[model samples]
Target: MEVKMIGISKSFGTNKVLEGVDFELRSGEIHALMGENGAGKSTLMNILTGLHKRDAGKIYIDGTEHYFKNAKEAEEFGVTFIHQEMNTFSNMTVLENMYLNRELKTKLGLLDNKKMAAEAKKIFNELHISLNLEAQVDTLSVGQQQMLEIAKSLMTNGKVLIMDEPTAALSETEIDNLFTIIRGLKNNGVAIVYISHRMEEIFALCDRITVMRDGISVSTHQISEVNVNQIVRDMVGRDIGDFYPEKTTPIGAIKFEVKNLTSTGLFENVSFSVREGEILGFSGLMGSGRTEIMRGIFGIDRYDSGEIRLNGEQITIRKPSDAIKKGIGFLTENRKDEGLILDFSLEDNIVLPSVDEFSKRGLLEQKTIDEFVALLLKRLVVKAENKDVPASSLSGGNQQKVVLAKWIGIGPQVLILDEPTRGVDVGAKREIYLLMNELAQRGVAILMISSDLPEVMSVSDRIIVVREGQLAGEVLKSEATQEKIMNLATGGN
Candidate 1:
């Protein structure tokens, strides 16, 4: 099968997302779609999948033009999309999710439970998955859920599979499994459109690379003919010298401590501390309870028993507001959903947390809001037309900076960031790292939980490995290595 989209153009209000974009995918080939955020990658894919109507374009599948009315029509033509956001019903079992809309039925139209389960089992076995079909999606880890999503996309045997940032939530081992599955699909002559910000994955899995920039198709290159540097340069219009910024700092006295933290069935007796002007990284596998501990500390979740001390004084926190009042900030992993209000303007979101501070006895202060927002938006280097634009209008990098600006506006003493640079570009990542260094120099303590091992090792002053809800080992930045961290995280040494 061959799929081609040519002369694609789309617009939303005043913003032109895609302009005369062209992309192609041939059968038995994995094509990578590379671009910075808001580079028309999603818009182009959406047009192909019939989620959005193109102002001007023609889509051809197998030499025949296709004018799909909706996503269902696109699917009927053997096209499928696995979105960046996981679409799963937490209350439903794995089999139920796989056969959600198109379930096995008998002659009388009754649901055939055994047949559905068998079909799901077959797909799982083909992918070398070890999940229980009866297990609820909520009970599964993020990596397991990711596998389930991929399996669900193949139910109709799609010829052209569109995957957007599929491995963002996966571990190294899980990514290997996914790549194996993708290879198997390619062997079966399935065309794949892979969208990702990870440069390494593109070089490893993709046979062809397509770069887009500023709502236009930049160029396409064969993997053998190009390198990461060239692709990055094409994507961002410049060479990104170093992937991660240099972290040089001195650790001060203890600024925050978690003593004997025990969360039932989640984490057990996790103890750690972050010193002033230091980055303390918590490294672990996908489900090693690293995020759970951070959630508990941020008061988004509860812990059975623990002692939280700030500046040698114990503080009680039963809710997120309590943590905020105590001068703590939490940067969630899913920034789109948890960190910011997508519909709100940059100015509104910047002062959202400290709205009370800008309020008088019986009135709102416009000057106070304007001054703070102007200073922070300019200070954070948020790229936007103006402060009145909604957060959804900004790119991923700018949105993240806005999130940081929100916390900075609140004047936090301790900031907990979970996968802070998960989906950001190289330039934005360096900006964030520089911001972290600035924060550290200003005496703010940061507890960072990152799955990117090299990133954690590079930025953290000290690193701690967590294995199965327990603290496995701790090492200074100078002494930390990927091999050592992996061994400790897997219960060795």
Candidate 2:
């Protein structure tokens, strides 16, 4: 199969996102699309998959002009898309979710449960994924759910697949399995369009790379001709010297401590201490109670038993507001849900947690808020036309910066970041890392929970692992390795 997109242009209201972009993919090859956040990567993919209509473009599949009215039309033409967001029915079983639209049927026109389960098992095995087909989709881990989404796309019998950051939530082993599956698909002559921020993966898995910047196709190069730094320069138009900025702060006394934390079935016996100017990393498999522990500590989730001490003073945190009042901040794992108010302006979102600080009596001090917003925008290097722009108008990386700024604006003593760099681009990841180091230098105790092994190892002073809702082990920065962390996370001694 040969797919070509010519002169594609798209816009959202007044903003021109994609401007006459042209690209192509050939059969039996993996072509990667690289760009910064909000560079129209997702928009272009949506247009290709028929979720959004392009303002101007020509789509040809196998030398014939094609029009996709909807995703079903694309699927019918052997084109399937696996979105960055999970698009499965959480209430349904894994098999049911996989075969929702095209289910196996019996001669009597009834659903064939046996055949669906068997086929699902076969697909899972072929992908080297271990998931219970009968389990509800919501019962699985984020990584398992992602695998199910991939399997769902593969079931379409498509010759072309569009995968958008498919490995964002996957572990190293799972990523290897996905690459194996991609290799098999390539051998079978399937054309794949992969979108990701991981440069090493692009070099290892893709044959060609398409770079997009400010809604235009900058250039396309063979993977062999481009290095990670050059790719970053093409994507962001700037050289990011160090991906992980160094921290120059001296570690201080413990500022936040949790003892004997128990939250029923979520987590148990959780205890840890984070010192001022320290980056303490929490490493674990998906659904290993890492996020749950953070939620309990921040009072987002109620805990049955635990004691939280801030600077050696015990504090009773019964709600999120209480936690904030005690100088504790939490950045949730799901940014779209908990991080920002999409309808609100960037300034509004940044000042949300510290609105009171800018309030005069019961009313807001507009000037003070404006000044503060400007300062944060400068410090974070947020690129936007104006502060009045809606948060949704900004890129994913900028939106994440707003989330971080929101908490930092509150002047917290302890900050808990859950998957801080998840879904962000490479340049933005570096910015966030620098922000973390800067925060630590200012006497903030940081608890960073991440599934990205390299990130956990690089940015942390100490690492803790959780397994099956229990504390697995703790290792210092010098001793934390892929083998050691995985061994502890999977219950090895």
Candidate 3:
């Protein structure tokens, strides 16, 4: 399963995705692919797996030049790509998804459900994953679905596995279990192409690393030879001073409050407050109701009992529009589906929430709209060729910035950011943090929900831990530590 890609180049309508890139994957090795969003990491791998045609490249696999026609062909040849976005059919059961398109048939040409279930169960057992094969995928939490995708990929008996942000939705315990499974696979002569923006994971788990920037391979080295600083420099082409910028914004009086916010069977009796110029962090394990609480606050989900107050006055928000009218903005964790419309142009997505403000006499003002979108795009440092391009044309980090730009356009006093940096690169993450600081300085209260502990401690002025839908404890930034946060999150004394 040795793969070598030399001088790979690809273009879609003059947008060069990858150019003169070189990569190598050896059997029984964990090779890390590091880059900022739109730096061509995913595109390079897509070319490898035949998802996109390489305009210029030479691919040699096991000493023979080869090019797969499609993803199925790559999988049949023992190469599997587990994308950042899970590709499971939500309506189908776990067992069904695991055997999809490759279902075994009996001698009579009948479906072998029994055999498929057994094989799926065996892989799940091997991965230490506890899941009911009969359960529909949508019923499972995001973390559970992530593990299921991993198991499904393993069932292919792939010699080469390309995992993109595999742990983005996983908890600490689940991440540990996944790392163990990956190690076992490497031991079994499998070559893994690991793509993640989390630097700690790359340094900790990968054996070798290759960094890409601006659609070209910057450098490749043994994991032991290069450090995080070197990788960051190679990916961004600059030394972005600090990973998390200093929080100098002064905290002000209480600006937003939630009391007895309860969603039946989801969260109960939850209460918290964020003051003007304050960044309140919500930390917890996956499925700890952190996201659900934000959903309730933003009126995306119904709360059984709750009182939301703003600027010392209570406000009733029956829908997202109401919340927006009250000067509140929400950046959902699921950016692709909720934050931005993939098919819509960047200008459209950014102006959607504030479109009314840019209109007059029941008609849109194209000039005003263009000016507003241009301003926010420049402010957020969103790298896009043109505002007329679809949001899908941008990378993950740029897409996130576009989402942030939309909220920024509204100029909300209270903003809720959930997993703001999930799957974003180091350089882009620093830029986002700086923007948060600027917002806080301008008297905006931000409630951020994050699974990354260091980010929570560094970015938030104060941290509150949630456990199984309850506020476990609170700690200030000065006194916060990884151990302390984990203790509070896991119900430790």
Q: Please tell me which predicted candidate would have the highest TM-score against the true structure.
A: 3
Tens digit per residue, CA lDDT, model 3, 356-390 = 99878999999989988999999887878899999
lDDT, residue 326, candidate 2:
86
User: After aligning candidate 2 to the native by TM-score, how far in Å is the CA of 271 from where it should be?
Assistant: 1.7
| Residue range with the least summed lDDT across 10 consecutive positions in model 2 | 392-401
Question: Worst 10-residue stretch by lDDT in candidate 1?
Answer: 422-431
Residue 147, candidate 3: Cα error in Å is 1.7
Query: Which parts of model 2 are misplaced by more than 4 Å?
Result: 91-93, 132-139, 382-395
Model 1, runs deviating above 4 Å: 128-141, 374-401
What local distance difference test score does each model get?
0.86, 0.88, 0.91
User: Which candidate has the top score in lDDT?
Assistant: 3
* Poorest lDDT segment (10 consecutive residues) of candidate 3: 137-146
Assess candidate 3 and give its lDDT.
Answer: 0.91
Write candidate 2's Cα lDDT for 1-493 as tens digits: 8989999999888889999999999999999998987788888888987989999989888889887899898898899999876888889998889888788999999999998888888888888888988899877766788899999888887999999889987877788999999989999999999999888789999999999998999889999988888888898898879887777789999999999999999999999999999999999887789988998999888999989999999999988999988889998876765889999998989888778887777999999899999998888777576899988777666777888888989998999999888778887788889989989999999999988898999999999999988899999998889999999998999
TM-scores of the models, in the order given: 0.93, 0.93, 0.97
Error of 1 at 217 (Å): 1.6
- In candidate 1, the residue pairs with backbone N, CA or C atoms under 3 Å apart (3 or more residues apart, or in different chains) clash, namely none
Ranking by lDDT: 3, 2, 1
Candidate 1 has what TM-score? 0.93
